[model samples]
Target: MERKLVLQRVVIVISIISLLFGSSPVFAELNTDQLRATFEDNSILFSNNSEDTNCSPNAAQRAGDAAGELVGEDNLKKAFNYFISKGAPKFVAAAIVGNLYQESKGNPILRQNKGSEPNPLKAGGKYHPWNPSKPAGMGDAWGIAQWDPGVAVLYWQQQAGVQGDVTSLEVQLAIVWWQLQNLAPTSRKNVLAEMTASGNVNEATSIMVKKFFGAGIPRTDIRAAYANKAMSWEPDPSIAAAAASGAATNCSDDSGGGGGTISEGGLNEEQAKKFMMNYGENKNNESQKAMGGYLWNNCNGGGSNCVSFSVFFLNKFTSTKGVYTPGNGEAVVSYLRSNRRVPTGKTPKVGAIFSWNGGRYGHTGVVLGIHGDTVIVGQASCSGPGKGRGDGTQSGGGSGFIRVGKINETKAWLGRLPDEFAYPEVDMSAVANYVGASTGGGGGNVAL
Candidate 1:
């Protein structure tokens, strides 16, 4: 009886200990398992919601669902709004979202050695450089929507005040908007409309899949997989007609009255100026760096200082204007005169180029809001390392900016390179036509 009592006590003690300690994976909660499950379920849900007759739940829906899970509905809406505000055609955005759905199913996966899963991280070690096969993990590619590191870097640098890591989910949504703005249209709304007008969802899906993915994946499978899911998207009414008309669908001039408008091709004179103001506020600079960063990063291919910013902005605004290569100074000048002309002093509009050196090339920047004598300029630059290294006006050897024809508190002498430099008169209509041809692939048409 004494031995039995001892055994029973020992058993009770062990039971108590077991109850107190549970064993499981330490990081299960953060591993994103719950999100994965929810994503799978939503794919089926969306597939069933398609209005098109031929729409059926399949691989496309699965792909879209996976992609959707990465972005979520709320983020998706925000991304759509961003592109819409930037003058992206609704259909083009739809197509891009669809393409992303197909590629990696919204997972940020890049192939290194060859196309394979469970790839190791390239940047797992401190000295590692980026490689497609090996993922950097977490901050490398963090959501359903995926973007290149260069783009992610740019997004974080530009968007200020929003606290949190760029790898976080919320930041991914904002970056998605930026990604959509970058893509050139593969298909326009008219093409999709024409296909759908004949009442063939399968046909439309097949064509889009082929264009983006090529023969890598079978068309039938891609169409069936996404048929039902893709049909559920309802194009925003404001952009539906324009999309159908085969308008260039990407970041363009904003349509607000006070500032310039951006078309799908890029910003108009008014819109370009507004972009500067927005860029300035985001960069948190009260002086030339803001302008410099815009000019240099936009123009030159180097750092995000004044010179490169201008180069990038102008290149974006005028797609025909070649990039500022090391020996292409003369070429850049010729393009500016023949293809890209700026506004006159009388007009003094935003985005006008203040040329000097007898049209041999002086400097350029988007004119921010003009207030009396102070002409706000977004000068691009090639800043060196330091706190205020690349701010626009700290000129010597590095690229910078200066206001011509006037000097004040906001404006300073641009060293007076010359008095009356020639300004080219580029045809806006021709530029628009060039944009239409370059994007949307030859014939301009798309479908959602």
Candidate 2:
């Protein structure tokens, strides 16, 4: 009788759980206002009323021509004309706008959903946040030019001096225009220089044009456009004047730690010892401060701070003090290349160091879990997650898997975790903090 009673209770509990978790959700989808706001974050504008064929097919070429009407043309032209007043060439300005349009779909105000599908790293499965129904991806890559989150934020801060909720598409759009006006360069010589440096000027220019439109426009046509506007178009002498003249500024939370923040949950024995040692000697006994300093000075910047967070973590985990010998970043990269083992796609267990962009440090993230080609990872602030790059948002942080183990030259290395690390024992706080914290919270916690 007791067994039957227990069984009945179990059934009731199961039924309740099903009812609570199974269907008929109560949360509502975003309304139009929210949708508009989201789109507003990732969009841009440009035009081509110029005689130069290069400037002809600006944002208006594809966006306006397709819609059979002008889209952000007046605003774009005004901004272009303003650049001209500032000595920017009209042709050069059009070319700049063309680049933006190709990159950003010419919306000038759209949101990039960081949680959106086809995760760039190609992580399998969609991101399942606590609120499953919440929107995925962060926001669209806004403007006529599609700048990533980091670049976008840099442009915004440099130009508009605006910072706020990164998720707000409206703010992102404003930043987009501000970036075009103030942060973007307008030197025809510089443009030509960049084209020439790419090995094939025609090919490079063609790529730019293709990026703007769906193709069919030839390089010759694009060059003609450029030529028409080249001389007639004035140069914007102060294209980047805003950034140069602005106060000391920082964009994209720049904490060397990934995402916008750092979490110091995982520490091997040696790492813990080093943390204690650093704190034991520092004037400020705060572990957080020490960790933050370490990230900024040693591990976060381009060259000096280029050591992989995990490499530093391992050195500290092993109680190795000051593994960060002063030298070019190449030495550290070489060390990782030599010491780290590779993970075959078929069997990528946890604790693997993954390199991207052909070992160029184009981007790096730690593999938290692996299943087939899909990999779950924790990425740092390699780029911005929303429209306005530096706007503090957790979208830039936290744990998400990507499918990168499948690619070649993309190698993974296995590291020794402390004996204390059991399944579910790995300290993912850094990973979590990276994927969850905003730019303001960029504290390097692994070393701590």
- State the C-alpha lDDT per candidate: 0.32, 0.29
On the 0 to 100 scale, the lDDT of residue 392 in model 2 is: 19
Q: What is the clash count for each candidate, in the order shown?
A: 58, 74
* Candidate 2 lDDT, 277-376, residue by residue in tens: 3322322423223234555333223111223333443343222234443223223323443443211122222443433333334444344433223333
TM per prediction: 0.28, 0.25
Tell how far residue 380 is off in model 1, in angstroms.
27
Q: After superposition, how far is residue 394 of candidate 1 from its true place, in Å?
A: 40
Runs of candidate 1 exceeding 4 Å displacement: 1-82, 103-142, 146-162, 165-169, 179-232, 235-448
* Strongest candidate by TM-score: 1
Candidate 2, residue 203: the lDDT equals 40
Error of 1 at 22 (Å): 20
